[model samples]
Target: MDKATVVRKVILFSALAATVYVSIGTSDEAPVQVKIPTSETIQRPAVSVPGTMQVAEELGAESDGSDPFEPRNWVPAPPPPEPVKEVVAPPPIAPLTIPEGPPALPFQFMGRLKDGTDEVVYLGRGDQPVVARAGEVLESTYKVISITPTQIEFEHLPTKQRQVLSMQSN
Candidate 1:
C-alpha cells in the first residue's frame, strides 16, 4: 500500500480502538448516586382551616340532589324573552309631489342607435350632443336605463321615476 493509505488506516484503527475502550471502561464503573431526600413522608394536615369541612357539608345539604358541576344544575333560561310583539308598522304616506308643472330636464332626446355590441342614445343638452350607452348617467341626475332603435328609457336619480323618449316620425 502507498504511504498515505497506510497512515490513514492507522489513524482510523486507533480512533475506533479509543472509542471501544472508553465505552467498555464506562460500562464497568457504577453510576454516581445522589441522595436527595424528597418530602414524600411529610403528612399534610387533613384540613388547613378549622370548620372548612363543616361549612362545605352544610352548603352541600342546601343544594338539590343534582350535582353542582353538572349541566342540568344550570338555571333554566328565562322563558325566551316574551316573543317580542311584532310591531305593526304604520301605513306608508303618499310621496311628496312637485307643485310645479311636469318636471323637465334641460336635455332632449335626439336619436338612438343599436349596434351588435351595444345600444347607444344621443341626447342634446344645450349646444352639446351627448352619446350615452345603457346604464350611463347623463346630466348627473338622469341615468339611461336602456336604449333601443326607436325608444330610450331614463331613470331620474333623485325621484327614481322612469321617463321614456320615443323616436318622432318626420
Candidate 2:
C-alpha cells in the first residue's frame, strides 16, 4: 500500500530473482516431476462425528469406558517456586589524592632546605660548581631544579618529561 512497502517487496523479489538466475545459469539438464501411487490395505472411509460427541467427551469419557478423546495419562507436574531477587549494595566513594613523595633529597646539595608539595624537600644549589657529582655535596642558589657534574635534568611542568642538559662547566 505504501511506497516503503512496495520498495521492500521489490528488494525481496530482486533477491529471489538473483537466486533463481544463479540456479538456472549453473544447471545442465531439464527438471521433471513424477507422481507415485501408494499401497494401503484398509482405507477407512471418512465419517462425520455427531455434534454432541465433543460434549460427551468433556462430560465423562472414563465413565463410558470408551474414550473417543485422548485418555489424559498425564503425570502430575512438579510444584513451581517463586523467583527471588538479589539486593545489591551501592559502592563506597572516596577522594582522589596522590601518595606522599619519598623522604630522600632530590640532590645532595647543601645550602638551604625547602619543602615542595608538602612531600618533596629541596636543598639549595647555592654557590656550588656548575658540575656536581651524585655523591658530591655542593651549595646551590636553589634556582636549579636539576643539575649534575655530568648533566642537568630539565622538566617542563605540563609535559612531565625530564630533558638531560650536559654540563659544559668551565
Whose TM-score is greatest here?
Answer: 1
- lDDT for each residue of candidate 2 in 52-129, tens digit (9 for 90 to 100): 555565555445545455556579766897788898988987878865432223343333222442222223334432
What's the TM-score of each model vs. the native?
0.37, 0.23
Over 4 Å off in model 2, which ranges?
A: 1-60, 63-81, 99-147, 156-170
RMSD (CA, Å), each prediction = 17.5, 22.7
Off by over 4 Å in 1: 1-97, 100-102
lDDT of 1 by residue, 34-88 (tens): 8776699565556555354454565555544444444663676666566667899
Q: How far is 167's C-alpha from truth in model 1 (Å)? A: 2.0
lDDT of each: 0.74, 0.50
Judge candidate 2 against the unseen true structure and give its global Cα lDDT, from 0 to 1. Answer: 0.50
Clashes in each model (backbone N, CA, C under 3 Å)? 0, 7
